[model samples]
Target: MNFLKSSVGRKVLMAITGQLMVLFVVVHLLGNSTIFIGLINSYAEHLHSLGPFVWLFRLVLLAMVLIHAFFGIQVTLENRAATPQKYAVNRTLKVSLASSSMIWTGLTLVLFIVYHLCHFTARLTSDVASYAGQVPGDVYKMVLGSFQHGLISFVYVAAMCALCLHLYHGIQSFFQTMGWNNDTSLPLISCIGRALAVIFLLGYSSIPVFILTGILS
Candidate 1:
């Protein structure tokens, strides 16, 4: 309890949660990537095969997102409150766009997450609801129908950009915060982190792009 109340502890919590979220993203991408191989329906079947446990899995996923987002907002606010007034012309010598705009990027991701849940999971909208019922339990066809649209795919790609920026800074800083990296290795870690972020961006963005371009259909 005491440790969690400390500044360093909060950062560590954020780092840990960030890693968990990253892992989830990677796993999710792999599952969603089944579309490329025509295994998406099988994948969805496996998930639905979980029976009542599907709800449990969803509850856990929801918990992960809430905990991560809660800590993220909390830490950002704390940092801003602790920071003193800065110079009129802040030096850009060491600052990067992702590092400087963590708050905004984070909030953007949060909003995207909510919309994504409603779009796919709940299938509340007319278009998505139509797809959900087009071929009962056909996750692939449903995904195909929804992503075939110009606007939906565009939003997905845009959201992925926000995710890329978040991971670029989040993953690099996570290593430093966890003491898993030293100043000498920081540059290399940053390079590796950037590569991973780009991979994720390309991997995820590819889906919607391919769908929109008639390549995946």
Candidate 2:
């Protein structure tokens, strides 16, 4: 209870959950990349075959996301309250845009995630229904068909841009919050984080672009 009430505790919770979510993102991208190699259908089927475990995994991921978001907002608000006044010297010129807009980027990602679940996971949208076939588990077809739409592809690419920004800052913060970085190593860690973020952005954004352009059909 004391830990939950403390600001440091909240930051620690956010860091742990953020790292877990990052891992999930990497795994998800790798799984989705199977589309390029022509194995996405089988991969999707294998995930579905997990039956109850799939739901269990989803529930765990949902819990992590909620906890991460909650603590993230809490910490951001507390920081603002602590330093309500802007620095007259304006020393933040060195900060990256992503680091400065964490809250906004995070909120954008939350909205994107909800839309993504509805569009793909729940298959609630007509866009998905049109291509997923009578069987609900044809995830490959669903992904390919949905991305064929120019607007959907654009939205996905835009979301990936938001995700990249969020990730670049979040990864560096993760290391900092965990007390794993020192003066000598912080620069390297930051560079690695940014590299990972760019890689993820390009990898995910390419899927929609490839699909829409008939490169992956």
In terms of TM-score, which candidate is strongest? 2
Candidate 2's clash total is 0
Could you give candidate 2's per-residue lDDT for residues 102-168 as a string of tens digits? 9988988999999998888777788886644433466777888899999999998999999999999
What tens-digit string does per-residue lDDT give for candidate 1 at 146-206? 8888999999899899899988998999999989998799999999898888889999999
**C-alpha RMSD of each candidate structure in angstroms:** 2.0, 1.6
Worst 10 residues of 1 by lDDT: 130-139
Q: In candidate 1, how many clashes are counted?
A: 0
Off by over 4 Å in 2: 131-136
Clashing pairs in 1: none
lDDT of each: 0.84, 0.89
Give the local distance difference test score of model 1.
Answer: 0.84
Error of 2 at 116 (Å): 0.5
